[model samples]
Target: MIGRPISRIKRVVLSALSVLLLLLSYTWISHRQHQINPQDTTIPSWGQLAEGAKKFTQPDRKGHRWLIEDSIATGKRLAAGISLGIIFGFLIGMFMGCIASVEAFLQPPISLLAKVPQTAALAVYFVFFGTGMKMYVAMIAFGVIPALAVTVYLAIKDIPSEMLDKAYTLGASHFETAYEVVFKQVLPKFIDAVRLCIGPAIVFLIAAEMVVGDVGFGYRIRLQFKLTNMNVVYPYLVFLAGFGYLLDYGLRFLQSKICPWYQNDSK
Candidate 1:
């Protein structure tokens, strides 16, 4: 953390140095590999695929030749899936944590289902939503919600007895005490819960898109693989990594802003 901050000049200099070092390393290694083999189908080591992005100016079946619509559709599905999925997951998770008998009853079923990989749940969702945004949302939510439930259940169970006793002494009912007292203590961690799943969400997102996406980074990857176009493949990899990184950083920023207390405690 201490080493992360720098003035604009230092930051720019450091970034340039990093880029130069990466280029030099890549060129040295790639040249070594090429000399070892007279005939290599591999494209250039760096910026080879960037040229494909320029090819977007060419033509699709329509006037707009690139898969830009597919990109937007995939992007929309991802954004909608993560935002709505997490909200519903959190609400459903709260129900899981807050109800005693319900929690007990759900445990056996949750455990049974939880042992299964979330991708396996797609068959169930596919039947209901049939490969649309709803299927994607359900897939994302089913994958994510159990982890949330585990966290919330632990949080609720770990609430101090004294806190509950104090609420009781003050004449708060069980439900009121749970909301006003128990929940306040765990709120910071709940924010962390939302932040925690952003990575998993993105991972599942790419997989979901790759499996069912008509257009998106994952689809681009599938397209390039089929065409045997390794040059285009590099761009898709770069794009996916860049998108995931930005999303992770964005969540970190939001977590810091909305959850100053959580940050302070961790520090």
Candidate 2:
């Protein structure tokens, strides 16, 4: 009974109700705060939110919208960091899982890296890569790579020994066995791992931007917060939540298409 599935209509209704309740709660809180202080920027009303949105969308004297500029800058860094992390993490994990020597050599270092709090190592990243695109990419990549590699490594290890033996018996080389046999089995799980890494990657990127960034969502948020511009901050936060949700939904769609047989937690 606890895990029983609901109808599609029921699911939609429940989801809408949940969102409606959240909006109502926020509106009530904002109204109460406004009553106390008309000038309070902490809990912005709908009008304030609209004005904030316009401020971001409208071009400045330089004919550049802050929202678009920040989105482009942040999007580029996020894309680069996630891509590199996936590539390197997959390779390292595949090797570590399949090869004993590689595992022995790389495991300790990767484990140590995983233990290090990437956000706290901002100074290290700054010194090594400078306060530029490289720093943001490195921070995000390092933040998620270790966990991803470990996920892949474990997934690879979970493969049944009989499968590998059959592949070898049929004249499959180590390379063939690794890719043709092991890779397919692990692809779905790897995608899931990447999906899980998305949030952490965003956090790392935003943290770096907040600390030493000229432009990005994090930069804008930090700048506006300093000015007590809650209206702008709230909209930006909502936009970020929407963006992250879209990324997650896109990944889920991709996984469903590629691995139709694999069971995914869609909810």
Candidate 3:
């Protein structure tokens, strides 16, 4: 218990130190920019960024707020999209993994889809779903599903044949063998795949939101960018990074709870 606590303390200290170093570096650059070119408006001071965040949280002239309203809007679309991708992708992956014929039939298309740039398909999605929340969800789902399915298929396929043979020898039916042996074995790996997909899913989410969204974190970023307010843009970008980190951490915690026996290389 003491060892674990000490390790956690060390991790916290190191993480804090890393962030401090980053801030220090930014401050140094800001100082140098002032010395060299005091007229530059692009490199915003941290204080300005904080003020921008405060302004963003408060109601704008139009009575709309980012922190309260658009943040939730983005969160909902992200949740819906990721859930749809993961649930359906897991099923598709399981089928492809368990059934050789299904794999043979689907692998080519799945591979092709995975290879295709998800951002490039934005126009196609816009045409079908139009400029609605569905378009955002559809884009993210389209981005995530194929890659996740492939990860699942490979994880299941990589399960040792001897395990399946043992299951069969023990009077387990095909479905039981597939579900009990293959599915159970692949669940942890599937979690890992989900972890991997989170970044790309956010990328697709932001891309779609920037292009077609009425309100979202991404929309706010794009809006601020258009207005050339680096103060708001910089802080929003940091917020986005923090959100992604939280997601990665949450998924890691979930993985640890569900797959206690699994050793995480990252840890």
Candidate 4:
């Protein structure tokens, strides 16, 4: 146990150091380039980044306040979309996983639709949801749901057949067998599915936000890119990376608390 924690700490420290080194290297290169050609604002320096950070932290009416407000709004949108995707995915996936009829009836269409690239469907979503926050939610939910459903279907389908047979032999009804035997056996795996869905959901969120959003990390990135403000953009990218890490960490903590059986093997 001591060794495991030490190893994790070492990895985290190494990763942080690596990021710091890269940033320093970038700043150095950008500074050198700016010396050569004053017109090049492609790569921002440490001073510029400091200025960006100051602007971001300050409650300036013109600059930093938008950062806090936009971040909150974007977080809410991601949460809402991902939450809806998980619920819808769980139900559909559970049905397909447990019921042969459902699998036969819906799997073909779902599999086909899943193959359709999310970007390709953007125009369709915009047509329906009209380029608002609703479009963001729809786009994210659509992107996440198929992958989540497949994960769940596979998880449940892989449950040992003997367990089901035993439940049925003991006079359990279909619903009882599904809920008591199958669902109980596979509950932890649902958390695992949620873990898997989060990455793609964020991707979809960013894509939608870039196009339709008034305020989001993605929107900010797009805005900065056009302005050639690498300083602001880099920090925002780091914030996104940190956000993703924190989100996954929270889910892992939840899994450890709610699905203690998953940790049995660790002991």
Per-prediction TM-score = 0.78, 0.96, 0.91, 0.87
Q: Report each candidate's C-alpha RMSD, comma-separated, in the order given.
A: 4.1, 1.7, 3.4, 3.2
Q: Write the per-residue lDDT of candidate 1 for residues 186-257, one digit (tens) a residue.
A: 666766676677667766766767787777666766777787676667666666667767777777787778
| Weakest ten-residue segment in model 2 by summed lDDT | 258-267
The list of candidate 2 runs beyond 4 A from truth reads: 264-267
Q: Model 4, which residues run further than 4 Å from truth?
A: 1-40, 62-64
Q: Tell how far residue 228 is off in model 2, in angstroms.
A: 0.8
Q: Who wins the lDDT comparison?
A: 2
lDDT of 4 by residue, 1-267 (tens): 555555778999999999999878886898899999876767776777887777566787665575797689789889988988888888888999988999999899879877888877888999999988788888888887887788779888888899889999999999999888777666777777777777777787787788877788888788878888877888887788788888889888987887787767555
TM-score result, candidate 4: 0.87
lDDT of 1: 0.70
- lDDT of every predicted structure (CA atoms): 0.70, 0.92, 0.85, 0.82
Q: Which stretches of model 3 miss by more than 4 angstroms?
A: 1-10, 264-267
Backbone clashes under 3 angstroms, per model: 2, 0, 0, 0
Write down the worst ten-residue block by lDDT for model 1: 38-47
Model 1's TM-score against the true structure? 0.78
lDDT of candidate 2 over 38-114, digit per residue (tens): 88898999999998899899998999999999999999999999999999999999999989999999999999999
Q: List the residue pairs that clash in candidate 1.
A: 59-65, 60-65
